[model samples]
Structure formats: structure tokens, C-alpha cells
Target: MEKKKVKNIFVEGPISAAFIGESIAKHSSNTNIGAHSIFLGQVRSDVLGENVVQSIEYTTYADMALEKMAEIREEIFAKHALTCMHIHHSLGIISAGEICLFVFTSSKRRRAAVDACTEVVERIKNELPVWGKEIFADKTHQWKENTL
Candidate 1:
């Protein structure tokens, strides 16, 4: 089976919550997934003791994010029998506790879907072109770019 069918990537500023949901729901209905799991990653208000994340401004390094996402999707489908997968991440000015990323995974069984969902999110965080900056409520700011 072709694993590339479910791969999708988008770079946008302040993406809407509804849009992300719809993206996941757009998968082919003929695909019968007995279980579907979604993970919503919210931008927290604080990071380390010296830093505060009142908002997050995410930026990408061009098409790199999409390429990495496709790789991750292929890995997920190869490892698990997933019916579909969707990943959506916001690109700018995300407020505290607002979602920065959303991951949706489906499979014929609950166990595989749950496991692949976790793995996909971890891969995205460790390998995507996306970079984020944290702006404090007090107006101070710092880049939250990961070493990965």
C-alpha cells in the first residue's frame, strides 16, 4: 500500500483551529479506522524559570518542514497500519495555552493509532524546519528554537 497518501504539510501564520480539525477529517472515508487519536500541543505560558512564553511566533526554513513531515508520515505508516495521519502546526503569534500543533492518527486498532500518534509528534518536534520564539507577557522575548 502507498504510505504517501496521507502526507500533508502547510505553512501559515496563526492557522485556525477549525481548519486543523477539518484537515484531519478530510481523510478518505473508505479507510476504516477503529481508533483515532489526536494530540493538541498548546504553547505554555512559561518555559524555564527565567523565561515566559506569553506567545509563540513560529517560523519555518522553507520547504524543509514539509519534507521532514513527509518522511515522518512514511515512517509512521511503515511501522503501523494507519488508516490516515494529519499534522498541523501554527506559524505565528500563538497565545499562551493556545494550540501550536495538532496531530491526528487513525488505525484499524486502537493500540497502533495511539502509539503512532506519539511517535509522529516526537519526530516532528525533533526534525521539522519550524522554529519558534517565545514572547513574554512583560514584552521580553526569546527564540525557542530547538537544537534538533
Candidate 2:
């Protein structure tokens, strides 16, 4: 069987609540899905010395990131009985408390939904070619390091 390619997951600026809501609402017609797991990655304000992070400017090598995400998606589908999955990441500046990443997974069983969502999130953190610049309240910026 032929495999599907992963679509681009980048969204400009911060992801809005309305978009996320609509995404969930659209899944109402999928009767086969019994459970859904969603993960929202929000920017955090971190204090370093006298400066506090106000926002994060995200950048990525889009082509490479998408290819990597596609690999992850295929692996997850093979390993888990997921009905569907969606991944969205933000580009540009996202303020603290704003959503930067949205990962949603649905499955016929709750365990598959939860496990697929968690694994996708972890893989993206470890594998994607995404970078962040932390913009501090003092106007200084520093490169971010992925902790996970």
C-alpha cells in the first residue's frame, strides 16, 4: 500500500483558541473515534538573571521539519491504531501564555489516543529542526534549548 505524505505543520504567529476549537468540532462526524488526546504547548516566561522572557520567536527549516514529522506520523500509525492525528506549530513570535504547538490524536481506544499523542509530542521535540529565540522583557534575546 502507498503511504501518505505529511502536510506542512507550521502556522504563522500564535495559534488561536478558535482554530483549536474548530478543529475539535470538525471531528464530531467521525463516529469511529472513541477517544481523543490533545496537547497544547504554551510559551513560558522564564527569568534569567534580571531578564524575563516575554515571548519566543520560532523559526524552522520547514522542508526538513515536515519530512521528519512525516516519518514520525508513519511510525505512529504503524505502532498505534490511531484514527487521525494533527500537528500544528507556530512560526514568528508567540507570547508567553499563548499556544505555540497543538497536537491532537484520535483513536477507537483511549490508550492508543493517549499514547500516540504523547509519542508524537516527544518525537517532535527531539527530532524536528525547529529553533526558538527567547525575547526577554529587557529587549535582549537568547537562543532556546529544547529541554525534552
Candidate 3:
């Protein structure tokens, strides 16, 4: 059997708006795709008792995460009639209001694209071995909990 190829989905820091716009622009040429669904995960400042979160430091086991993502990609493709799908996640410190995760899915129909995008985002959050440390304004930090 041939070895499976894994796609790298990790970005250095925050995902940029220009990059997102460019991604959408690039897909315009693909006439087969009738609909596109996009989900952008933004860092939010939350108050933890007396401390307020300033930023979040994201980290992941690259190899494991890639492997798991590949599995998710396969599953999503099998379940949805998708023309294309892309996922990008930040791997470093991301400030509040900055984009950290981007999930884009395209399909001939709107339902498939929307469903696939939502499923992929949910899987990535619950299944991937990625961790985030919430850094507070007072220099205190704590591990973030994954919530649906």
C-alpha cells in the first residue's frame, strides 16, 4: 500500500484577512463549485474571576494533528459531495479579536458545503490534539477548555 500524504494545516500565528480573501478569490475560477462555506475562529477575551484574557497561545503535536486532520478530510469528503476543502489553524500566540482558525468548504450545493464545513470544525475542536493556553492581562494563564 502507498503511504498516505498529510496536508499541513498549521499557520504561524493569526490568520490574516488578506489571506482569507485571497483564498476565496482563488476558488472563483472553479465553476463547478456553486457554494462555499467558511468558518473563522476568532480569539475572544474572557474574564476569569478578576483576570481578563489578553491572548491565547496555541500549540499542537504537528505530526499527530496532521494525521488526524487527514482522517477528518477523508471522512468529510466521503460524506459530502465537496469540490474542495481547506483548513488553517494558528500555532502561536493570537490576540483577542484575531483570527485563529479558518475552515473553508466548497460544493456544488449549499447544504453539502455548509454541513461539511460545520462538521470539520466540530471534529477539529473535539478530536485534534491541539491545546490553547489562555494568557490573562495579569500574567496568569490557564489551559482552555474545548466547548461545543
Candidate with the greatest TM-score versus the true structure: 3
Candidate 2: 10-residue stretch with minimal lDDT: 1-10
List per-prediction Cα lDDT, in the order shown: 0.77, 0.95, 0.95
Cα lDDT tens digits for candidate 3, 2-112: 556799999999999999999999998999999999999999999989999999999998999999898889989999999999999999999999999999999999999
Residue pairs in clash, model 1? none
TM-scores for candidates 1 onward, in order? 0.81, 0.95, 0.97
Tell me the lDDT of model 1 at 82.
87
Question: Once superposed on the true structure, which residue ranges of model 2 sit more than 4 Å away at CA?
Answer: 1-4
Off by over 4 Å in 1: 1-8, 11-17, 20-31, 47-51, 145-147
Clashes per model (N, Cα, C within 3 A): 0, 0, 0
The digit string of per-residue lDDT tens for model 1 on 35-130 reads 888888887777668666779888886566776677777778899988877777888688886777888888888998899999988888888878
Off by over 4 Å in 3: none
Candidate 3 TM-score, true structure as reference: 0.97
Residue 43 shift from truth in candidate 1, angstroms: 0.8
Question: What local lDDT does model 2 show for residue 48?
Answer: 94
